[model samples]
Target: MAPEYALNGLFSVKSDVFSFGILVLEVISGLKSKGFYHPNHSQNLIGHAWKLWNEGRPLELIDICLASSCMLSEALRCIHVSLLCVQHHPEDRPNMASVVIMLGSEIALTHPKQPGFFTKMESHEAGNQSSSTNEMSITLLEPR
Candidate 1:
């Protein structure tokens, strides 16, 4: 069976795109960022990056880990592309083909729409429930 977070049945290709975007940010930042947090703020890392981009301060969100080694333009472009993958509507997200093209070329990119998650209030609750159920199922099957 596919493990949770395996991006199997739980996620479509678009979802994988979202995950890839998150992974890129985590790799650059050396921080694990989850999508559902903050009751008042519906924005996750992608949303935060989008906001920063809109404010013309995208660099502010860069990881301190890259402070000395990272190229400014490349890092900014990665962030911009990551935000594009996490757009609210799945149809708005680019397929892997277009994503590669966007990354490889200086093609004009579209602005991302607001991300999925209608509210942040249920984020923790839902995650906890899913994890708990998975654990329980495992425990029940183990030999006592």
Candidate 2:
């Protein structure tokens, strides 16, 4: 999950797109961003994925599970779409409607910006903030 608070009460269909992006990366890489820990700069799976992507070697991030079953173009397309959905700027991320279209079409895609929560620390900080907010809002008051 991309920290509930990160959705900032804007949790519409776009929020699902963000989640789908993360899932796609995990599915492709066989690595969960949450569980990832690196000694250098303490980056997570998202950072590593971005790094590989920037290096023009995104194929290095693909999961072994896809070795024989996946088509190269399709796998790369999924990665591209996933990256697009996870761009740090919400406005840069595509809506589900556009995502569906992008996936179905063979047209060239725009370059992806960096994914959200680029570092493990950022992810941890956001998660902590969200947890505290959730704790404070435990009361059940009637809506006006």
Candidate 3:
């Protein structure tokens, strides 16, 4: 979920894009984005991916099941595209159209800026974590 939506109860197309980005990363890693915790780094999935990508070890983000069969280049591309979609500012993210083009071609991608919501588990709560998410989405109708 986008931080703005979580913090301010507002959502837009960019917010859905943010959710889509998380979904892509989850698909690649076979882990839920919201609940993933890295004990060593004290970071969630986005933070973990950002760290791995910056350290030149992005393949670590790929699921072990696909470790041998997945093409490194394709997996890296998906990571890159997903990162772009999760930039901290909605304006910094590519809309869905550019996302489609970026996914389809070998065009050089701009490096992603830091993603939002890099929350960490409290030191005492890191390992004893539960499988629940802090889900906070709401929908309502406004009278026109």
Instruction: Estimate the TM-score of every prediction.
Output: 0.65, 0.73, 0.86
lDDT of 3 by residue, 41-117 (tens): 67889999999999999999999997788888999999999999999889989999999999999999999999988
**Candidate 2 local distance difference test against the native:** 0.78
The digit string of per-residue lDDT tens for model 2 on 1-144 reads 553446575555566788888888899988876657544545677877888899899998898888578888988988999999887767778998998999899989999988887765655543342323354556788989
Q: Model 1: which residue pairs collide?
A: none
Task: Give the clashing residue pairs of candidate 2, or none.
Answer: none
Off by over 4 Å in 1: 1-10, 35-43, 118-144
Clashing residue pairs, candidate 3?
A: none
Q: What digit string (tens of lDDT, one per residue) describes model 1 on residues 1-144?
A: 111224334655587777677777676666556533434455555555666678889887777879679888888778878777766556777888898998888888877666543234345553442323353443456677
Q: List the candidates ranked by TM-score, beginning with the highest.
A: 3, 2, 1
| Candidate 2: residue 91 lDDT (0-100) | 75
How should the candidates be ordered by lDDT, best one leading?
Answer: 3, 2, 1
Off by over 4 Å in 3: 132-144
What overall lDDT goes with each candidate model? 0.65, 0.78, 0.87
- Could you tell me the TM-score of candidate 2? 0.73
| TM-score of candidate 1 versus the correct structure, residues matched by position | 0.65
